[model samples]
Target: MNKEDLLKKYFRQSLSEEEEKEFTLLLESDHDFKALYEEYSNLNLAFKSHEAEELKAFLTSIDEQEGVKKIIWYKSSTFYYLVAAVLIIALCLPFLLKPSASSLYNEFYEVYPNVEQPVVRGSEETNTYNAFKAYEASNYSLATKAFEELLQTNSNPNYKFYFAMSLLNDGKFDQALNTLKDLEDLKFSYTDETLWYMSLILIKQEQPLKATSKLELLDKLGSSFKSKERKVLLQKLQDN
Candidate 1:
């Protein structure tokens, strides 16, 4: 059988003993064939890993919100195969559709929530409060200034993170990326979040290859921050 047929059976786990020997020989002797096999193997593994993570997160969210016991559906082999098949198709459909990177960015990008400060009405006009208020209001230009001021004295990663986000929202892509890169090197609560935004900014800048690299690193680091969305975006980027 040709290498393509070999790969098909290999992914399906249906290669006969003789075919398996041929596959191994090709892998050992043909550099390009080995690379092709590795590429497909990695993509398959990524899809499976992404689906499993999504299922787990979904059940966990249901349990948290509804106070119900988590379903253990993943323990069943039949259910696993069904989910894998469905997700592979669902995930591949976007590539078949050939959506642009800009559309994908719009689909996936949302302003990070202000989990640090509550924007209460008629509250005291503290600098921190003002910064978060502007961010919540979508006045990114104002938020950027406020965050910059706060970072001057505080150097708080939280403030810097929001500052970077504000820059991103304000279309200051270079500055936002630089700030995020700095955050990536620091030990902070927002490392995954930082990587996530960095990838988004790269996408917005029409740098899909760079964005994919960031996404791949984020995936390798096993970040749960936007794990499902990240996997989908990563696959789409790869396809493009």
Candidate 2:
């Protein structure tokens, strides 16, 4: 099925296991699909909120009017037009709220998952294993220390990338930026991801111009990594 059908199935919670996997792959790799999903998700929230507000208003109006008198009023054609107006407002609500850069960053930024060395149950207790375990468990301090030690003997770009992520998660923004900058210079396997994270860090640091520069470069590179999001974020930054 197409992404729209997959998303509809997802919202209905009717996707089969295989379809669920396909949906996840599209969400991960297809930036346009991810953007569309986010838009729909936000619209869903707006609709739910609008429904709750309308229900509460209806109850309030009922309580204010004579017993069951206003109930008949709601059956009028005017009431249907009011409902249409409310639905239109609900559809427009998400677009009406202009989010700030930091809010956008928070909305878009997710911690990079440990795809390099996934920790398995009953694995051997090596330092690398421990590092990944700590990282996976959100123990950034231990993960940072372990990855730092691992870096002493190994120069893997993957190690450096996750080490930066650990430091970033531990609130070491400057260190993370430096590490990502180094990785960016290296143009390693995670170059696209490095630029993406760097842009996020810059956004967090309130450096919109620098962040835009990174995103613009990423755009020019034509990398698939968050391509649609990069464009959206860049536009938001420029508009701000």
Candidate 3:
């Protein structure tokens, strides 16, 4: 990609590994590109601040004008400021609200917690059970390893789903997304659930529109399991 597109992707937190590496190299080796990026960053901050302060002043003035006679909100200068301020704030809301991808991930990502059938006491437990035990105990490192081992012998979709979760917990996001994407297309019982997690992954990657697309797909599929969560998350993402 060119320098402008690379900088835009970097600001949007959507750079791939190779793109990120190239962006870093440009910052280190190209003085003009580095200077341009710094200038743009500063300009963005200044614009955000200006919009916020203008919006706040307009809002405060509306409250203060509540008791004044012969001066309606729409009839005063505050109204003009309010209109301009709202437009600017709308354009800059994402930066102003500071929506955090990690915060959203932590809020919605829940562990499956248990396997379908509980192992009976005195029964011979296998590596699969051991993996579930590790996951239940929150030992994701060991759980991820055990999950990979399970996948080696059996291509159980359930095992693959849990393995994807383990990778997500371990912060292997790209790998986890890839696994979830494959699961989403498999028409398994978890295909809907896979779509939900994939949407969350997209949100965490700062790709809200992509996440919205996934949510729309889930809605079209009539996924009752995640319908409410999907709606709430989609609203929150779109709001920012």
Candidate 4:
């Protein structure tokens, strides 16, 4: 194939094992070949290691942690993982800039995570928790009402997180975006889930610049959510 085709295949990630092996042998041949390989190799590394969305989320998350210049070691590690999660999401679906956070979160549910059924509560909390659970189940309208009520009661930040997310699943796009933007202002424990959802919301809100900003940090902090997700997100960032 021509150089252009090769680059195209590489971008598509459609390289066959035999083609890869032949390419590897070509790399071993001489300085000129090595140089050519290096160019692509470096580009591939950048594609794999760079993540703009993760960076955007990190900056958004850290800015809210206004109490201390430095967090405890554990939160620091958590921060590290959060960056990883951003890259993972980006990598899995290159050019999926407009995907709903709900879709990605569903993939997460299928992974090693166990289902945590929320406990039933008083009227508003009950409705909120139920709405969140419905959101998890991919039910939108019920969750929207539940989350809206939960937001009014102001019981817990965690619930609020779900409330905002439910609004998204329900197609209350404007409301969901507004809720998440408010969450960005308040300092809460930044879960990968929260950031992932927030990133999707940003994209839906037509904020590619913000998404690219997060990708930078996530690329640096690798192996989060799972290695594949990290690699894919990193690739997307670099490729873009």
**TM-score of every prediction relative to native:** 0.57, 0.58, 0.57, 0.43
| Candidate 1 vs 4: which has more TM-score | 1
Candidate 2 lDDT tens digits, 6-110: 999999999999999999999999999999999999999899999999999999887877656676778888889999999998987775666666697798898
Predicted structure with the largest lDDT when compared to the true one? 2
Clashes of 4: 19
- For model 2 the local lDDT of residue 142 reads 98
Give the clashing pairs for model 1: none
The residue-by-residue lDDT of candidate 1 on 1-240, one tens digit each, is: 889999999999999999999999999999999999999999999999999999999999877766532244546677789999999989989765888767888999898988988999898999999999999999999999999999988989989999999999998989999999888877688888998898988887889988988888888888788999998898878887
Q: What is the lDDT of residue 194 in candidate 4?
A: 50
Off-target runs (Cα >4 Å) in candidate 3 are 1-98, 117-120
Per-residue CA lDDT of model 3 for 1-240, tens digit only, reads 888999889888999999999999999999999998999899888999999999999998887777464467667998999899999999988776866887887788776555643545675679888877777777888988999999999899988898888888788889999988778878886788788888889988989899899899988888897677777888888777
Q: Write the per-residue lDDT of candidate 4 for residues 159-199, one digit (tens) a residue.
A: 66677666666667678666766666455654444555555
lDDT of each: 0.89, 0.90, 0.84, 0.59
- Superposed model 1: Cα runs more than 4 Å off: 1-97, 121-123
